[model samples]
Every structure is written in C-alpha cells, then in structure tokens.
Target: MPRFVFIGLLLLVSYSGMPQDKNVSQGRSTTSPHMAWEDLLQEHVQEDGRVDYKGFLRDKQRLDSYLETLALQPPKEQWSTQARMAYYINLYNAGTVALILENYPVNSIRDIDRPWVKKRIQVGAERLSLGDIEHKILRKMGDARIHFAINCASISCPKLPAYAFTESGIESQLNQAARGFINDPQRNTISPKQAEVSKIFKWFRSDFKAEGGSLVDYLNRFLDEPVSKGSQVKFLPYDWALNDILP
Candidate 1:
C-alpha cells in the first residue's frame, strides 16, 4: 500500500481501538443541549389545555437532537437517576405524538391499532415502533404517573404537553399535570352532585391515595367550585379513541 494510504489505515485502526465516549460514540450532539426540562414543560401548556402539537412538530429536530443525549448504559453511576426518568418520559411523550402524525390522515389514533399499522420509528437514528416505545420502553421502565403523562391523541386521554420533559422539573411537572387533568371537565371535573371522573383515578386510585389524598381530594383541588364534601362520585366512560382535530 502507498505510504499515505498505510498511514490512513493505521489511524483508522488506532481510532477503533480507543475508548469511545458513550454520549458521543453514537454520533449524538448534546453540546448546549437544553438542560432545563421546565422550559419545555411551560411551552407544553396552551390556553386551550391542548398541547402545542404544531409547534412541536415544527421543531422535530430539537426533540431528535435532545434524545441522542440519553445514556445507553444500564441504570448505574454512569447515568443520573433523574436523567433516566426524564429520558423515559420524553420518549413516551414524543414517541406518542410521532406515532399519531405518522398515521395522521386517519380520523383517529384508534386507526393505528389495526394489525397493518406497523411502522418503524426513527429517534436519533435508532428504529423502534410506537408500541415499542410505549409498552416495551416507557411502561416497562416508568411509574404509574406515566399513565397521565403519555397522551394517546384522544380528548379523554390526558392532554399532551407542548414542551419536552426534563429531569430537573419532573416533580413540579407531575403536580401540574395532575392538576391540569383533574381540572379538565371532559377528563374529570363535574358538578358536586354528579362528578364524572377519569378512569385514571379509578385505574390508579392507589397512586393518589399513596400520596396522602383520596381520589376525591385530588379532584377537589382542581374544581372551580369545590364539590360538596361527601358528595357522591361517578366515573365517566373514558373514550380510548384518538383525540383528532376535526375539519
């Protein structure tokens, strides 16, 4: 081989042998990556209680870029506990919205449930499907609050926030999410005499109670006019179909 070609081959071998920076090895850039998940959380909330989907879709590059910073290592000293939680939450939320758009022409997200809707999802050049992100990744790794955070594009489903999630702001974000969902009449609030609750409270009644509040206490925090104490509560039939924009 020519001398220059030989040198080039030697350099390639040397580089391959060197220890790779896991964050950079994947060819992801976290340089000046958005560190405050709160900024993303604030942007997520809109006046209408609906997330800013159009804005999020427009900045798809940022979401993809940020996710690349996620650690591929096991939950250990290499990864901050907070980072792991933020990563899982971000993936769940972002992947869900991506799934809806990938199949958006359909009237509802329910359309994606058919056996034929299978498709590959590319995040940071890694391919996984919506099902993989939700059931395989988020559900497997996250806590019960996730049921409230992961929006399925349904009106009855918890609304997707416009901003991204970060570890720093998770606690406040969760409280805000719980409050927001509880206040939305379509989701949970109703008159004192006839309260129709989200299946969320029923499904995860233990989650709220665990935090020192019964489902009633949780709902009361967000009620415009507090429901009378001791009022009977009823659960509304939750619509699991997709929350699509109507023409």
Candidate 2:
C-alpha cells in the first residue's frame, strides 16, 4: 500500500478503538446500552410491586450510579418515540426511588413536602421535578399507556415493573402494564354494569379520554369483563400509603 493510504488506515483503526460516548449514537436507535436500574429493581421490588426499602437502602450506591448515568445522558429529539418513552418512564421511576431513599422511613410519599413538585432530578443540563417528567414530558407524548408505566411510589399508583423498560420491547411492555393495572382487582373493579377504578382514571381523565369515547371504552381495552358504555363509574379513594414490603 502507498504510504499515505497506510497512514489513513492506521488513523481509522485508532479512532475505532477509542471508547464511544454513551450519549452519542450513530444511528436512529437511541437507548441506553446497559441498564443498571434493572438489577436494582429485580433485587428490591417484589413480584406484587411491593418495594423492599431496606434492601434498596443497602444498594444505594448502585442506584446512585445508575441515576448519575441517566442524568448525564438526557433524551434527544432525534431519538425514536419508543426510545424517548422508555427513557422518561425509567427516569421517572428511578427518580421516585431516589427521592424515597432520600427520605426513607416515611409512611407515604405524601409525607414529603411537595414531593412531585420538588425539582431534585438532574437530567443533562436541565433540573426537573417528578411532575415535570410525568405531566410536561411523558403525558405530552400523546400515549395514554404511559399512565400505567410511571409509578408514584404509592399503593394506588401502578405497580413498578421488576425489569427496566427497553426501546425494543416498549410496546409490548406498555400493553402488559396497562392490562395488569386495569385488571388488578385491588386497583380496579370492572363488570358489565358498573365499574370502580383507581383515582388515576379520575385525576387524569383527559389522558384516558384523549383518544375519544368514555373512560369505560379505555378500560375495556385491557379489562377481562367489559363495562357497559353507560355504566356508572366511581373513582376509588387513592391510597397514599407507601408500597413497602413488610417482614
């Protein structure tokens, strides 16, 4: 090979060997390469969605490392819809856990003053609150299924999944989450005549109705037994108790 051609090949190989930045992706795909959050979730979260706060406390360092990675790499507009959805959902869930750890031993998230409004989450160059991520970011994405994916660390809120959300599986994972939350009798009760559901439906009525039709229409999508279109719907009193595992 010519001397100039050999030098060019050497430079290409040298650049390729350099470590790539996690925030930068070469293609349309934009998802985290590794999810440390999944390991923590599998270890501390129960199958029933109850959390072992003590266990989380013991693994605080791991959780913090994962959160730091997320904070340094915020989602970009060029990312696919699934990628952004998964990122925000995971960010909200992980941020909630970090908040709880900051105030461990509390009975409920409500005990913390302005828990959702507090701007404690640091994502890239932006500092946001839990509410900002949920309402301003995720809700605006126009996917109502998001209501079931982001947890509020309360019994009435949707259960936190044991695995992290991935861009590749976000569609299926979201469908499963919606079905699980709607059918979980503890959270919702549906019949052909009347239905009683979690306050989530009431609080964010617009979200469920954004696609048009009544709340029952949305419930029927995931419910085993469909509620009548004109059936009476009642919102259950939200349980603000912490979803902590007991010995």
Candidate 3:
C-alpha cells in the first residue's frame, strides 16, 4: 500500500480504539421508553394534573412494568442534557407514584415511614430513594426548572403534567411546567407590591435566580404582571395533602 494510505488506515484504527462517552458508547434506548407511565398519567391524571390515585392503584401492573424498565436501564453521563433530565424527571415522578401506591389509603405522602430516603428502589445497579433522585442526581444536573418538574404527590408540589416528558420535547415541557407553577393563582399570590409564591420558590430560590438573576426577575418572564423591584416576597405554606382526585 502507498505510505500515505497506510498512515491513514493506522490512524483510523487507533482512533476507533479510544473509549466512548459512557452514555454515547451504547446509544440510549428510546424504545417506548416512558409510554406505559405516560399512558397511565394521560388516562388517570386530570387536565389540571391532579392524579386519580384510586385509578392508578387499580392499574398498578403498568406502573410496575415501567419501574422495572427504569431499574434495568439507567441513564449514563453521555446522554444529551435534555434526555438525562427527562429520564430523571420521569423516574422521579413514576417512582413517587409507586411509593404512594405501595402505602395507599394514606392521606398524604408524608404518611409513609422515611419515604424519601428509604433506598427501596432498584435503579440500575444501585438502590436509590426519591431523595437521591431529586437531591443527589437531578439537582446536580443544574437546572432550577427541575423544581417544577419532579412532583412529590403533594398539593403544594408542582402540578404533575398529564403527559410524560420525552427527550424530544423536554425543553418545552420544562418551560411550560415553570410557567404553569409560577402563574397559578391558587399557589402564587402576586401583586405589584408583593409576591407570595410556593415554598418551592423559597427552597430553590438559587436555582431560579441563577437563570434570570433574581426571583423577581425570573417571575417576570412568566407572570403577566411583573413584580416590581422592592416588592415584598413571602413563601407560602406547603400543603402536604395528597394531590389526588376526588370521586
């Protein structure tokens, strides 16, 4: 072979031997990934995002299958930021629902014994709790909008969407989630002089402020009427009642 062609071939082989990104090594599985969970949410979750917990309990099998899939297929570092966020968001929501169903007939998610840190879930090779999914992983992913994405099945939590988030539309979904949560009057008491919002905005103020400078600056992006500078802001009390639908 010509010297030039031989060098080119050698370089190609050497480059191919280098390790790939963890998530990129094997293409992320997109195979009906969250359909089961999505189907359940679409069917049983109300337009306002209230869940029909009784109906969910009756259709527990689908949730079990979805959880199994999540446990088997863990997301790796190489996945797109959008995809990683979506997966964790879905995992958090689905896992939370399963947790609630396991201890059903309860009035609220806090009824369970140490529910957030129980380490009862089998996610890939490790056991994780809702706390791990939220604090350890998703929070470190660096999106304050996530505060609105992960629901804890509580009334004060951001309303869980009727549709599941997918890599394809995660951005828009997150944007909508933020807007919906921040603008909902029942949760946010907003006015020119003051803005009292969910405890979430208080707890994760840094996250929202990071994106738009300050809490007020962020709210103006979504609020129809902007909160003026020097406005007094209060954190509303969190309602821990189950976000379940009534018969």
Residues 87-158, candidate 3: write the lDDT tens digits.
Answer: 889988998999999998889999899989899788779999889989998888888888888999998898
How much does each candidate deviate from the true structure in C-alpha RMSD?
8.0, 5.9, 8.0
Model 3 Cα shift for residue 236 (angstroms): 1.2
Number of backbone-clashing residue pairs for each candidate, in the order shown: 5, 0, 0
lDDT of 3 at 46: 94
Q: Where does candidate 3 have its weakest 10-residue lDDT segment?
A: 18-27
Ranking by TM-score: 2, 3, 1
Local lDDT at 237 for model 2? 87
TM, every model: 0.62, 0.87, 0.85
lDDT of 1: 0.58
Which runs in model 2 stand beyond 4 Å of their true positions?
A: 1-34
lDDT of 3 at 128: 93
TM-score of 1: 0.62
Ranking by lDDT: 2, 3, 1
lDDT score of residue 180 within candidate 3? 89
> Per-model C-alpha lDDT, please?
0.58, 0.85, 0.82
Clashing pairs in 3: none
lDDT by residue (1-247, candidate 2, tens digit) is: 9999999999876543312223423321233443578778889999999999899999999988888877877776667787788888988999899899999999999999899998999988989999999999999999899999999999998999997887767788899999999999999877789999998898899989997888999999888878888999998889989999976
